[model samples]
Target: MSRRRRKSLPAEPVRCVIERLSHDGRGIAHQNGKTQFVDGALPGETVMAKVVGSRSKFDELRTLEVLEPVAERVTPPCEFADLCGGCSLQHMAGDAQIAFKEKTLREHFAHFGGIEPEHWEPPMRSPDLGYRRKARLGVRFVPKRDSVLVGFREKRNSFLTDIDRCVVMDPRIGDRITDLRAMLYTLQAHDSIAQVEVACGDDAAALVFRNMEPLGSADYERLVAFGKAHDLHIYLQPKGPDTVHRIWPEQGEERLSYRLDDFDLTLKFHPMDFTQVNAGINHKMVALAVEWLDVQPGERVLDLFCGLGNFTLPLARRAGQVVGVEGDDAMVVRGRENARLNDLDNVSFHGANLQGDFTGESWAREGFDKILIDPPRSGAEEVCEYLTAFGARRIVYVSCNPATLARDAGVLVAKGYRLVRAGVMDMFPHTTHVESIALFERK
Candidate 1:
């Protein structure tokens, strides 16, 4: 058997009028009786787009010239917005971005779940720029350019974009991108450095370097010196995430922590731990989840996919008792430690895979009046069956992917739970990534 060859891209730029926006912020257009998804183009705009890829049903293009612009289109703040793939809707106005995300959530709910929310909560928002506290930067040494690039991948390409700064990232690390690039170029094992994982706390920032090769003594000294000068905590991971360890300022605190001032809670986590990238939105999101869940002082609450007790600890503050369950044992331990640190005795944590048959687990048999779920992109399909078994009267679902949330909503609705309220959160500004929350109550 032979595989069919992909069609070649057109050489000349084609003129097209963008009819609508796709879920990922790409503009939808039709040309030559086929659909074209153009990057950097907005709806109601006419542009010249260059074809870069071809598929059976559609072709992918990049806008080269915008002959007519739409009112929602604004100048991107980042200098490398055109080349960097870090953000998609940077050209769209901030207010319009929120509206677009809310619309996306609604569309997903109606199309996949076959229902609409009874109450539409106001969109949770935060600062548009310098809001990202966590990110993974691509590092590469290009011999042709005789320099090292330390930033995100280029748009529609795997190559690293030569960016000096990132507008969406927290300024503590964003402003140091050029310095990091220059530092990498000076290192002997520059080519061995594959990526940099950034994690920022309230007061300090940490960078974990994923190195493919061992560094020399001089290189180690230079990294330490750089960390000291910039007030950054540095870690090196020669292999997997478990191997990540701090090499600089070895005596002080290596843990990164953030505080929810309203709850008087401080949560500590490692550099590689799963956490919200936007700190501002996370603080607001937790408050909103607590409010919508309406956790009472006498109610028992269950928190699933709880990481470092971000929501679990806060829920414990309000509920009489809360049980936090996570898949990773390490996170469960951290969650317990966070509970202890906050001096909360009403919360406990357990490690169990929520995606599998969790009915045999000890926590599964417990009864609860309220439940909170914060699942990843895949959603909580496997665990929805057990909600009613716990005798949960109220459930609040915090979702990072709207499509999966909608699918699970259908399951809950079938199980006699009514979708009372739903809304989007601006966790990732200037990007199509949608984080949402919804409340469900027994009919």
Candidate 2:
């Protein structure tokens, strides 16, 4: 049997008047009675787009030329903005990007939750560029290109984008992309390096190289010298995250730590641990969560999906007692250690599958006057079922995905909670990924 060949993409450019922006930052237009999503085009703009993909419901196109530009459109700062998938909204003005995210949150609330917030808090803002403190960059050696690509994948493609610098990433690492590429080229196991995981703390930055094979002696020495010369903490992961160990400054603690000066607390974490990409936004976000929860001195609070006591310790400072629950045992342990390091006696952490049957957990039986939830992208559907039982008067939910947040908001509202306040956080600027926070109060 002969295999079928794929259909060729349309070579001709199609004119489109962008009606609106999709949640993922694509411009939506109707062409031939079907919706078309055009990349690199803003809402209220006329553009000529080339079809990259065609489907039954909608077609995907890349903007070839903008016939009419919107006021919000701006020249992208990064040279690789056209190809790099790291940032989708660089072409849109910073203020317009924030507005678009706020619009997205409002739309999700109305469509998925069947309700809207009574009060809209001002969208939290932060530095729009060079603010990313964490990232997992792909590294690929393509012989055809005759060079190793050390950056994010191309827009809507599997191939890595050949970029020398990323404006959105922390300048400490972003500025060294060329140097990193050069160093990798000099390594004997250059192709063996699969990824570079970056983690920046208040005072230092660390990079963990995920090596697919054992590094030669010279390669290892070169990595150490490079780390020393660049003033960076370096580590190698031979297999899994658990295998990540520091190679430079081999004497003291190599843990990366961020300080929350407002709370007088410091959180130390491993490079492989999950953390907010934007440290400034994270600090502000925690402050917002605490302010919204408004836990009184005698109040008991519950924090779900608590990682490294980011919220638990802060809440403990105000509330009488705070209980943090997380699924990862390592994270739970780390949270406890953070609490200990801060001398926070009122805060405790437990490990349990929050999305599964957590009814038997002892923490589930405790009454909470207020609660703070920061679940993963899947949202807290299963946990929402048990929230009402805790009799929490106020709940603050921090979400990375608006759709899931809206869905869970519906469940909470159905349980007699009112959507009191909600807003978006510019945690990830130049990207359509929305980080939102919402408050619900039992009426």
Candidate 3:
């Protein structure tokens, strides 16, 4: 061992002006024919960054200082903007962030898919602050800090940041951060509590606490009392997601819910349901998808990955028949219930694994006139292929991942579909998250 000497890593400091932002929010920079991805530097800014890591293609650096600040850069309003890993582009101006996102969307569509939308709907904007309706916050017992750390993850680390408040959360949830911490601290097994997932809508806000063990009697009483005092609903997760149950009030069932005004549907969901994190952007997204689909009376439509009938009920209003398909049976039951609640007979829900074959005889002859897909970040590549022969004249693809959207779009284009229009919606405002809708027509 003494005969072999280990080589130390190279120390290289690169100073460069950020030219643009990548999809993941890293500032792209180039200098002396080498490309560098600098963290914490915004576009159109000069900064000195110390090289922390590098790959064959790109170099990674942490910004030391902004030698020259861009006009679009501003002091982030949230005390946790840089510290909280939940959002990255908060320091960039709202308008500039939207512009960058739009440009990025367009580039993805054209460059990756080799397809161009003939028209573009202006990017939908939401209240730049206090808009997040869903979040999973991390909880840690930091003995050195003499307080429980309750917040999101720190930048580039799994350790939870000791955040007192989050400005981007809905006012109701944002204001309760300190109270939640206090209450959690009172629990008998405070060290066993991991994090709390917060979901809010018009009428109710629910906090689902994920714990490693069941709560003791004292802990249960403290949580229930806190919930009653704040008019909040509390759910406890002792094990897996199926184990999540309401611990507050000791009795009665209240389903967590969110309303989609554009859809005219009030969806009842479990505390653990997968709903959009941004309520404002979700409403706008439904409206945009409906508008792009151009639903007409007597037209049959298919809504894929339809969670709780977000777009299905809205489509039912304008189309003769709307079929909502989801992988979760529980969600399908809720979706059907929502349709019945709205008294919409034209909407039908089916539970099927969307990633699998969806073009069997029973699924093949649906005769849909239009289709709407809001798949997860995985994108609906296989589902897009299955829809090519479904006789849908128009298809509206709503995507949360631009790269996967671009890949699926390429598949659609090759199958005689033309991208008619595409646009972005600023859903997760402070974060680098991109939500976009694209319209494709059979050629």
Clashes of each: 0, 0, 0
Alpha-carbon runs more than 4 Å astray in model 1: 1-7
lDDT of 1 by residue, 67-148 (tens): 9998998999998998899998999999999999999999999898477989999999889999999999999999988899
Q: Please give, for residues 1-443, the per-residue lDDT of candidate 3 as tens digits.
A: 46765444347666788998877888999866778888789888899888776666777787778999989888989877766788898788899888888888878877874667889889998898889888899888867765788888877778787777888998888888898888888778888899899988688888888989877888888888999999888889999888888877567665777777655678777767888888888888888788888999999899999989888898999998888889989889889888888899988999888887777746447678999999999998888777877888999998998888988999998999998888889988978888888999999
lDDT-superior candidate, 1 or 2: 1
Model 1 has an lDDT value of 0.92
RMSD of each: 1.4, 1.2, 2.5
Greater-TM-score candidate between 1 and 3:
1
Model 2: residues with Cα > 4 Å off, grouped in runs? none
Distance from true location, Cα of 49 in model 2, Å: 2.0
TM-score of each: 0.98, 0.98, 0.93
Error of 2 at 218 (Å): 0.3
lDDT ranking of the models: 1, 2, 3
